[model samples]
Target: MATFRAELVIRNASVFYAHRFTRVNLAIRSGKIIGVWEPTVAGPEAEEIFDASGLYCFPGFIDPHVHFGLQLGSENCSDDCATGSTSAVFGGITSVFNFTPVLTGAEDELAALYKEVSQSTERYRTNLFMHLTVAEPKISPKKLVELALRYKFRSIKVFTTYSSSGRMTSDGYLMDLFKATRGTPLVVMVHAENDAMIDFREKKLSSDGPVKASHLPYLRPTISEVEAALRVCLMVSEMGGRLYLAHISSGKTVTELYRHFSALLGKSIFIETCPHYLYFSDAFLKGERAARFTTCPPLRPEEERQELLKHFYAGRIHTIGSDHCPFASWVKEKYEDDYLHMPNGLAGVELGFVLLYNLLKSRENEISVEELARMFSSNVSTAFGMFPQKGSLLPGADADITLFDPNAEWKVTLDTLHGRNDYDPYEGLKMKGKVDSTIIGGKFVVRNKQWVSTRVS
Candidate 1:
């Protein structure tokens, strides 16, 4: 009968802990998890009570990759942190691995991007952190890694295919980037594709200006990615470094990593896949949606989509990300004219978790809830060294939590979403589950199906 002193209490929520669902009540105090016990436990003294009846309470999603403060190839778009975080909040994500770049000019963009993140922090319904990619592409890669470390970024991402910002460092340089950051607690995130191969293909296709949707077969081929992975894995072993491949869309790339030659990974390489890559494919390219579906390292055939699903089932795929890029119709106009000209990403943050739940629950009925946690939260946190503090909802972790309705059915459409992008890659696809409520730092950011205007802790 004691009055519990707490900020808030979420009751009657069926919890998914580590994996299995257990009915429990959560007590949060000062933004930290205070207690998780039987729902009948005495109510703690709290400012508010959130009823999560008929819902599944799981650790809020930890999106391992995201980028903001940049536009569609230098063009303005609709959402910034305000709308971006709004989408994340609605999606039940509590933390975002904000992927940032060291701008083209003097590092002034670095300071400005940080400022945007900080200002957006208070407004962000979710916690936002960043990773910086700054190993000089041509110079001493070791020194570039040192500079990235000195800059205090959480991680590093390099593009093996894009060299516009000097992100494509040589293999020797890649090893240097890794060897230098090895024990420094910084993990390397590589886009993982061969720039030279892509360049050759692009040149061969010069006669085909702004290529067609069907041209994906020749442009940015999977072989380019597989060959790059082979090279990086070798370099990683040679340098004793850890690397994570970003948004792998094809089965051949996964097989190349696991079957043909994984000796180079040395057991340190991790795999990441995106939602769009899972559901959509070249099918759209042949239809009216071609422009809406183009992405770098383009989407593969349907068989490949099933192959990725198999990888997830077999545990060969580990980490997952959104690669959430927003390009409004205005920005997408060029690409719409020519598939090859379109920006290569989609707004996937909001729909990711629910889709995964639907996939596992339907096809692979026994996909361990623990496994889901590992891929969505724990695995990403561990890969980035952010565990025990940010990814779990245990008694002592941050009280960031999500309440999902396993039976909630909804159709995804732009009219129903918060991202700035006007088109959704998942439009009309029926989803069987959804996050009904999201709590970050003990504050009910999404309550009764709307955004609440208050901050917690």
Candidate 2:
């Protein structure tokens, strides 16, 4: 028997890996997992030991879709990297891939995008990565190459709507962008929706009277998303490039993608769905608090929400992102009579982990613990090329881990959650399986549901 020493040891934890659970001792040194062995055997000694008995330990979540320090219309996002990442850590996320907006006709588009991302990196407490939005006419395939080769960014975000923010990308240009990133490590993340389809519907609804919250679902129906998703799948398939559909809200789109699953298999086709989609419904859009529930690709019918859960349990949806675009409540109030003007986003980064975990537990068991780990962390890291380093609990991997207490129950409130936003869509809703502790880089940022360290000066 040999003796070894490590900086920290997480002992007797219920660790989820692959498709099952194992009780082991995790030895960590220099912010990396050094080994996983039995505590009773010849194992490493440590300066600090955490007894994680009865708690579940999974790899820290890696949120793939987030907008920090973002602006929508006249409203600036309430959460910046400091606040956003702090909230993220509270929810068990140790790393994030944020979106940086680049508009068309901007001189040196990549440089501008770099500046946006760089500003956040300095403020983020957890590991940070970025995916860029390339505006059409201003950005070209050559620019995409420069982004990938020079910036080392592995993904580009293209939207089919929100032209006001210069977020939209036309079909032709999207295909071109996909083709450009093809055969490379780069992935094209499409915010799937038909701009014209939504425009026509909004105009049709507007003719009746002033736009109201109830008209949201009518203006942007599930068909708009399905049509665009199918199109992106076809283009990516033809181009033989990787594609990631962000914030997918409907089952029809998932069904369409699954139909082409074989064709997209080796091409690295991936899909991301948010907690709001799985839990909320369009009916909420008609509620008195309608403005609070407003988001692009409006939540679909309840049945469709169920269908998405089925796909997730069946292992069809590749990853789950918070799409944590936070805005203040007053931003929605400004659009009272004009619902279309309301900012489309929610503050869910802090509650994402508990919401997803409780959703599965409430529904009859479908996904395994390992599968849950994959959806929240591993798959995201693998998709964005941050794998072994950011998503796994394997030896030599970064010591980013989350300790979850399945028996812990708590009520959702703005005070209980960490974020800069003033409201919580999930407010008053009781949640089970709270994050007990969050560790990043072998350092404790959150312990016992409280922030132990600060990234802000």
Candidate 3:
């Protein structure tokens, strides 16, 4: 037999696969994993060897929700594809699913939008995919599916609020969309919030006084989210469609989901929550820099935050998305006093894994590293049709891997991060674990907590 030679070899690592960890050696050639064997087994010859002793090796993470180069009003978000991808890699994310600009309700615009988004991602260091946004119900379902197949997108996003901005879809339209896409590979993602309730509350709040950041929870209240989530559940249950709820903020939403729709939990409904919602609370919205913590479905109260964490530990949450939309500090400061005009998002793409790992270690001791892998990497890939290939260490899978040192400790600050923004929402927070390196398609994009450029053949 010809000698087995590999381009790269990783040895003596605790590799996560099949929902468990085991000591193994991996051989890679041409960006694909070709061997996963016991460490005692004779290893293949390789040009380069990576000793990962005592490190935990996981499939690279996938952030299913992100908005790179998003434009809101007159100012664009600080991180474009180049900078955002760099931040993602540094945080152990090897791939991302970014949303397209709002659709114009015309089928002809699909190609143009795809071209535009594809061009923007040309400089991304991580592999990039897209989620189509159906802002208007004008495009037919058949065309939506066709376009998705043409573009290889696995999901579509719609909103139940933001009607004033022309982003809301009516119940009739949503139902129609559900019925049309049922039994297909396409999953409909909803920003579930009752628009009518919001409009009424906002009008009342505006009439009473100028809206401040602290009044965010009242302005869009948890009841609105619960009602909308129930409505979507009913629609999906009736139509037998796939649904994904985005950035679930209130614990009440999770409670109501289990209370009413337990049957659909993983079978048809997938839930995603952001790190900000899990870590910070409305308390962050009271300080002078409250605008930095502002995001849609604004942070909830401490009681609700604690409840959310409980459900998360109980395995009610499916995945974690950063919802990473960042604005320059000055841009947030521009509307500091005006809550309505301030953009809704924060920077978490670079700190998500570290923050969550620390939170889990401190609070949920029973939660194992395997569960973290599922939340941060595998489950996300499975949901978006990128499984095994992008989220597994199996043979023939892409060699996208992350090396983590569970003992490493670091403090988060604006100066220590890599995004395009000047401020970090997690500034001053102590992190217990850190990403040691990130490899994408067998190329070292980040090594030793620093980024390095390596071209893959």
Candidate 4:
């Protein structure tokens, strides 16, 4: 009688599934999950065994939106893919979806894409996926379609605001994009905010005094997000294509979606919210450190934040992304007087797992460990078309897994975190949970909260 052997076996892990966690042992072979057994099952011999008795094992987290190594305005983000993905793996993320430079219809498009892919392979440690960011005017629809179909890029992201970068894709151009992706599995992601409304408010508000952080929500009002959301949702429904709203920050936007949720359910409209929107309010922008909290579609009032969380717990929110675009402290320092000049992103990927865990713990009745797993991993993978390959722990799935200790305690500080960025927005915040280990493709990236294979040095 021949006996089967696993390459690696993990014992006594609380594996997350559907809406519950079950204690199980996992067997891995050649970078695939070969078996899922009851905790007491010990049928196979393995080359290596890891005991994870007190830990919760989740599918490796997949962040759907991250801007690693991308240049924003005059400066680049502090962390490139290698450094940024290192931080991500420390927080249990094993895969990420980032953007490439806007497709400019010039230069060989395929060549540019190959270069981007090569650069990613060289720079990122985690499994990296890319979305082509194309502006309305600069893109050639046929070329875009060719690229998407050929490379399986699977998603095209267009901003409804940020006209300064010529990224504003108007209704007409958006229709064209939808038309291009029709009858395909490809999706269109939108950064929805009314450009005209934001420009008007910023102009009116800055005229009086230096644009302060407190003025962010006012400059890009909830109405702006709601209006743009309504438009994009309608376009997606009318065009019969998928649409994803990125970094949704307003209860108003949620309310609008809720009104039409039933009709849009099978229509493929997904909503993603960020941790900052869930935890902090616009008041975080009140003091001298306002620049630190500045993000596009800026933080809303406390009441709105609560409402958004309610929607999240009710299963209305599709996924939670970090929108992790980090810059050095000096870049944030450059915009002391005016909010508009402040870099429009924050770093949170390394803190997202714990921060969200604490939030769900406080509201246990509304969310469960399994649901949190879906939001952080499975849902993102399904949306971006990386489902069973990257987000599942079932047999035959890729051996990407995260071991977490719900009872462990940790602090958010520069010394404790691994990203290249110099600032920690979550500084001084105490978390009740910690990442115990992270595995990517059966290889240990983090073990016992210490770096293993992913460390560059």
Q: Pick the candidate with the highest lDDT.
A: 3
Task: For residues 171-267, write the lDDT of model 3, one tens digit per residue.
Answer: 8888888887787778899999999999998889888877887789888888999999999999999987789999999888999999999998877
lDDT of each: 0.74, 0.81, 0.86, 0.82
lDDT of 4: 0.82
Candidate with top TM-score is: 3
Clashing pairs in 3: none
Which residue ranges in model 3 land beyond 4 Å of their true spot?
A: 1-3, 454-457
**Position 143, candidate 1: lDDT:** 55
* lDDT, model 2: 0.81
Tens digits of per-residue lDDT for model 1, 167-260 = 5655666777778877776788888887887777766775656566567656787788888877787777777768888888888789878875
Error of 2 at 442 (Å): 1.1
Error of 4 at 35 (Å): 1.5
Give the alpha carbon lDDT tens digit for every residue of 54-104 in model 4: 899998898888988868768788888888898899999988889877765
lDDT of 4 at 411: 74
Where is the poorest 10-residue window by lDDT in model 1?
Answer: 101-110
Backbone clashes (count) for model 4 = 0
